[model samples]
Target: MDRTELFLAIIAYTLIVQTFGGKAEGAMLPLFVLLFALPIYVVVHLYRNPSLE
Candidate 1:
């Protein structure tokens, strides 16, 4: 997929996960890592410089 399709796919995925993820205990790990921990880590890690991008 190209960038636009890939971006929309990710947005759809995140919307589903955020909307229904908390209804089940089994979803907690992925929900936490993907929605919380990973974004925070990425922002902090790239705050200085994201040259790798």
Candidate 2:
């Protein structure tokens, strides 16, 4: 999938299931925030390090 689609799917899946495939459910909020922030963080990191591409 494209980057945006992949990111959205990750967020949707994370929000949809607190446990995520019955593996665990100890830290929902932190997992959600990390899931949601990952894309933004990637963009910001890319902006800061354009030459890495």
The models' CA-based lDDT, in order, is 0.63, 0.69
Q: On residues 1-53, what C-alpha lDDT tens digit does candidate 2 reach at each position?
A: 88678757766666667545665464366556766788889899999998875
lDDT digits (tens) for residues 1-53 of candidate 1: 97457545655666677677776454345545555755776788798787767
Who wins the TM-score comparison?
2
- What stretches of model 2 exceed 4 Å from their correct place? 1-26
Which regions of candidate 1 are displaced past 4 Å? 23-53
Instruction: Judge candidate 1 at residue 7 and give its lDDT.
Output: 49
lDDT of 2: 0.69
Model 1 worst lDDT run, 10 consecutive residues: 24-33
- Residue pairs in clash, model 1: none
